[model samples]
Target chain A: MNALDLDRQLCFALYSASRAMTASYKDLLAELGITYPQYLVMLVLWEEGSNDEGVTVKRLGERLQLDSGTLSPLLSRLESLSFVTRHRSAEDSRRVLVRATAEGAAAKERAECVPARIGERTNLDPASMPELLETLRALTRNLRAEPAPVESPDPPAAPLNSHRASALTARH
Target chain B: MNALDLDRQLCFALYSASRAMTASYKDLLAELGITYPQYLVMLVLWEEGSNDEGVTVKRLGERLQLDSGTLSPLLSRLESLSFVTRHRSAEDSRRVLVRATAEGAAAKERAECVPARIGERTNLDPASMPELLETLRALTRNLRAEPAPVESPDPPAAPLNSHRASALTARH
Candidate 1:
């Protein structure tokens, strides 16, 4: 009942599963010569097919919950791969829009079967997917909506490994 | 319901939630001067508290599902921070053992409240935490257990964008 049992923490579970999910995409993504995150950007752009204005970089970041620091480099790589193109929006010089290149858009059809392959790998019930998705969304929303909880002010805190370990697993 | 719809993909959902969970840990982890992944390593070591014979690098890799390329640099950083020490095992020179320094072990007490803080942030019912953990574990297990599925060879497939877009949302 150790409080920090790696298996018991939701954070570890999420982290582990997320990494595993990424790993699962390795070979699949390789087919399209894009990394998983790159594929995600393409997904958004492909969904917006033929929107000449494409998606604003800001909108892409918002959709993916990525900051420009991360998104900018990723977009650049996608651009280098010819999977996507980024241009300053005509109406807003300050804004950049990301659209899939012909090559990138063509990858989508090949990508269509990607999810089904992943679905089979997870062995998750399609019927249950909706509920699972909802739970994850709720988890994300709740985590994002709140501030980090405050720690108690106390002297007996540090080095309580053995002592506090009892309390960590005691409740959960 | 575009298969490429960012909102609809389970992979994106997991990716977003995982990143959010990591973000939620920012302040909490900053207090410990460790990154999210580094904290995870500490969690494992702390759980093995006072074991003179600490965990092997191989075992740590297995436990964390991280390769040596990633784990080695991380361990080096932790060692440099004086939070951990690594040495070659007696019986197996090839096997390295990692143990926490007094500083790292003591940090565990302060970290005890971390999970509780995160749990509060998730706002998940304590009663249902176990189920969520199980689902995540199952997902990781399944994703890791399989090889990537094979794609069929057919020229009719490459440009199924507009044609297949109809089916992606239709099913899901």
Candidate 2:
């Protein structure tokens, strides 16, 4: 079958591509002693910085689209690694706030080189990254519109038609 | 940050979207007693028909961009479930051929409704399916262009633009 006929479901492509990308990151993350998802949590914390009000598990889950069943154990693993500390919030005892430690923040410097390493490996131009990011965010929004119980609220809106442009500006 | 920011890596969005999509599938596949990857294998064999020449493990790996490490265990699980069979070829003892059984062929009839069900959950339109699939395949090729040892002499060429379309269209 030719391309037109073989166009498998978008789901399959998403599935395979995601796994392939994760596989590429395996060796890199091994050096950091974290899995891909753990690295993502570190990224969120790094971008927000440690002094900013730490993020809650629910908030992190909402952004990452991961449920507690996965996040809880993952958080514990990171905590065991001393990259993050999770504690019950005083004002809201039910809420758990996750904060990165000094060591965790230090990992960012090492990680800054990571994206470039991956970019080099993939041979995708750094200039074209925003376009790719926009497409992915669009796909994520379209796929994630359905709300689940216990899910965190969506992030504040990016400017209309601003996804690619905003990402591009950030790089510079 | 504008579109160019390295902070806005497409990798995160793609990775998260993929995980979210699979999470959506996990619940759906639970009813069918199959996982997401298993469903893809079923689709391939179903489209090819029960008596069709068995798909080789290497070909499956090539199509899925999976290594023997993952595919071997997964295929074994499928065999245990009686959905497929793996046998060594007499002509080429080193080659293993994977063929679906009658049960596996019949499973497709049960699965015909899965695409629509998943679409309902994700709110993705079938018309948009081609574009999403194309983008994924492009990303996969971009990522796969990196060097890796050839697993077999007859490695399937990157399907890229045409493979998915032909395989999928022939079914409809």
Candidate 3:
């Protein structure tokens, strides 16, 4: 078997599909003056019904599986766009909270058309969406559950590229 | 129904799954000093059996669905690593071609271990992989077929934020 074949790799499949999906979202989002990741944050804030209290940076990070380094800049961009507001928590001065501005929340209504539009493009049976979602969610959960293996402290005697030659030679 | 709900979106599911899957590959790939996308390029070169003639940048772009803006920098980095060689095609000076180096070709042996390791992490039934791939491929095809709606040339009468107020007022 050609183990090196790209078509055989599930990771490649997911990676390609994800990028395609994001591309579909890109132009739609550009009209809203936001990126896909920014839209994701908006979804979270809209769903949480964030008000004056707002969602904390830490909580937003946990929900989005993003670190502060990523979320901070994103939030700042959203703030500059007048789509969101970020302020230090009154109860806890050290904690920062994020809330969608009125425009950000209103952007939701315009966004209402997004999913159906994307759905039409996919030509996927609406009936099958749940099944696909289930499979993908399970895959995500399983993959994220375990940590990747750490590199070996010691180096291999043969250089990395030699492995390809040895394997190919064996195959021939 | 909350159309804006993040959980209800298939795009979000695919987006999350893709990131998690890539994360699973990170440490495994780090040992080889390559990123996931770089590994993808290697997989293609190995499969094509690229020789001195090599694959053109344009051909590589089509296969990977990446534009030159993205591929150029990536190819340069790979060249710096000595995993791949990039040169102007003899027949066409205007066209640059990319081919795997001896080390890059040999790196395939080390990469042979990646799929099985990812499989173990996903814990997906081997029988189910083909089915999932088919579904994802279809999704990608469908999403890529349509162009996003162009933004309005004129500005709205109300501020973008007021759209939220109108939407919320209509809901109440």
Candidate 4:
């Protein structure tokens, strides 16, 4: 198989694996009433202490690599669920601060089991996990340092060329 | 310093990198009027010749690890763009087949440059590329092997736990 073959490409493998990991989380998160992204947001809040000034949407976007469009709606959903609250920064009106409520803080206890569950799902040995993290971080760093080559002509468009005849057969 | 550190997690690294890669693609894909997921769907169809009945939504979702909710909307958007068509199978009404249009096939000529562009963005030397890919593939594989643990309810969800806080600091 060629290097660019879907199965051969590490990017595809990582991409597929990531998708699968997210899928695995679907059921677990469903009970929490949140999607993967939402769960990630919640995770961030849980770690940081939701009652604090909270994290900013911009900061959240930076960490998550999501833009305002995705993050805004997601935050709204969390707010509606009462998992978080959106507050305007006193110093910077342009910035939004997201703090967790009592209920949100309470949710943390429910989420404690999540990491272990995820660990089990991945079946990743604790020892090798660090190396794997390093590799992914390196790749992500490299990708982020480079500029995007293609620009969309339209604003917020969809996919272009697609066919049904071929399926992405996994080639080892 | 600890394994539980968010920065130390291969999953978070992979997740972050994937989001970064896709975010970078937004401008490029938008210029082409396609989203990142749409581009992937196109990759499967275009590379496969989109000439056959196209790919089934279920098959596409299975390979992509996406459910019907995500796939249905994405396919519908593709259909609106005239890139693909979605129809029910005569034998199985529950099944939906996606086929590309002539225009969709032609779009490939324009997109042939995507891989190279994305590769350049990664800044990985040709020699390092394979190793990087292999490591990511391994990590991703490990993550997909087992069922992820579910979220357990107990104490309230904390936005930032001590472990995660330290991890975040370490990440910076």
Candidate 5:
């Protein structure tokens, strides 16, 4: 296959599959009255166990790989929907904490069925699903691995083609 | 594995991998002076062959799975960058045609090397890459499969819980 072929690009395949997966979640989540991102937030909170102190905003952002600019608004929307509540942590007033609300927690019972439904929609063999997950996990790990810092002795105003490529490719 | 566990959910895996893939493309595409989405547009245009009559906006949307609302601004940005040119098709004025400019065509040579570089970053065995690609393609195909029209005899203002789940699960 040609390297530039859209159909052959693994990046495009991931992009398309990710979007399709999210789209498939739409109607399922609509019943629960939360968007997919909100559902993700709920997942984190639900995983936290009910008695634990809520997660700090920074922690949630780190977990989701989303910056505050994106997460702030999403957290706000989830708050408005009564799916989550936010408060300043007692230990650090500067830090905000987020946790799923009672309504949000109740929604989980319904939400539990979502993954299996989405799984059935994918029509993937149960045996092969773990392999697919492992591949995607490995890909993400490699992509997120930090590039070794470039030690440019004579800093150019702009990165040259070789510099840019090296910066992108240096990560294992 | 718990279906809702953040680390275990295949959707989360896909979502993270997709975002990470785009992040890795940032520096490579920055050298080309295009964002990742813009780079995707260029890929489609490049694949149309140098002399094709260009692609219609609607056709481009269908190809990219983006709606006019999203593609309009993206196409406009590409035009402003002089990488692409758009005009009303002569045969059908209602439809717009978009084609790569000479400058855009020139970028393809540079872009050709990107996939291999990304492949290196992924660190997956080249022999196993095709299987991964096939898996992602199958996942996307199954997710996008349209649900059969529901023949609901009882008309209800809101879909019941079971109805919603059936609507989502019936696609496969």
Candidate 6:
């Protein structure tokens, strides 16, 4: 098999499996009027247990490993649905804090069935879950620990066009 | 810890790791002017080895676990980049075939470094990779094997609203 065979790549395995997991959650999450990513936010708020202080956008970003650019739009959608409310911190106006609303908290009850439903559907062995979780977590941790790439001083060259195509194609 | 803790969910772990993997591929793929998903398609095409009769769109969709709705736009983007060409099959006008252009095949050279780059970035142990792949593949298999949800005749009820909110919150 080619070393670059798509099936042989760990990244491909993770990518395919991840999308499969998300697709499995789609209909169930639709019933709760949320997407999979939105469900994740609710889980965080639910875990915080109705705290008035809530979580800062920065903290949520840190937890989710997403930047403001991505998180802002998602948070806005949740706010528009009235599932979440965001307000400037009283003590620090510059900081925005997010909390689950009554509706959001109530949504949790519907969500509680999700894990069991997924479990039944996938028939994933419960005994294997802890180990699987640990492996995935380690992978994420290692990937995240990499140093950021240094910016290239030069602009990227134009994509290879047809002139060199025949030679390149011949080699493959 | 709450059973529903965001950090505790297997789906979240997979989702987070998947995004982390994609992010790791970004700079490298940018150099080749392709997105991660697009790169996956190329990998499949490259594996098929420059045959004149390329894979059909239906076959591509099955291999990628993506429906045509998603694949159509992605294929268009790859076509625009001159990496792949799509044409109606002469045998069946309805069937569209996708093949890597010479440029696409050449890209494999640059892509050869990707797995190693990702390996170094993640610092993933080579010994652990096979077991990890097996676990993830099983997860995907089980998830995809699930029966599609039965459509509910009735529209979902409005969010639980305030009446049920306090009870749900208290229980948590």
The DockQ-derived docking category for candidate 4 is acceptable
Q: Hey, what RMSD does candidate 3 come out at? A: 13.0
Cα shift from native, residue B9, model 3 (Å): 1.1
TM-score of 4: 0.70
DockQ (C-alpha based) per candidate is 0.34, 0.29, 0.30, 0.23, 0.34, 0.28
User: Is 4 or 5 the stronger prediction by lDDT?
Assistant: 5
Which docking class does model 1 fall in?
acceptable
**lDDT for each candidate structure:** 0.78, 0.69, 0.77, 0.66, 0.79, 0.77
lDDT of 6 at B150: 76
Q: Considering DockQ, where higher is better, how would the candidates rank from best to worst?
A: 5, 1, 3, 2, 6, 4
What tens-digit string does per-residue lDDT give for candidate 1 at B57-166?
78888888888999999999999999999999899899999999999989999999888878767876565566567667777877777673465443222221121122
Better of 5 and 6 by TM-score: 5
Q: After superposition, how far is residue A154 of candidate 6 from its true place, in Å?
A: 25
Best by lDDT: 5
lDDT of 6: 0.77
Question: Which ranges of candidate 6 are over 4 A from the true structure?
Answer: A148-172, B148-172
lDDT of 6 by residue, B37-144 (tens): 999898888877367689888888877788899999999999999999999999999999999888998999989988887876665546556656766776677677
Which sections of candidate 4 miss by over 4 Å? A1-4, A30-33, A49-51, A148-172, B1-4, B30-32, B49-54, B85-97, B128-145, B148-172
Off by over 4 Å in 3: A148-172, B148-172
| True-structure Cα RMSD, model 4 | 11.0
Q: What is candidate 4's lDDT per residue for A78-130, written digit by digit as tens?
A: 99999889999999999999988888788767766666777765654454454
CA shift of A27, model 1, Å? 0.7
> Candidate 5 on A1-172: residue-level lDDT in tens?
5789988889998999999999999988888888898889889889874776888888888788888998899999999999889999888899998988889889989999989878867776565555567667777877777332344454232221221122211222
Question: How much does candidate 3 score in TM-score?
Answer: 0.84
lDDT at A95, model 5: 97
lDDT of 4 by residue, B1-172 (tens): 2333456555577688777677666666776688878877777776563457767887777666678899888989999999988888888888887887887777777776666766666654454454445545554555555442434444222222122112211221
Docking class for candidate 3 = acceptable
Each model's TM-score, in the order given? Answer: 0.85, 0.73, 0.84, 0.70, 0.85, 0.83
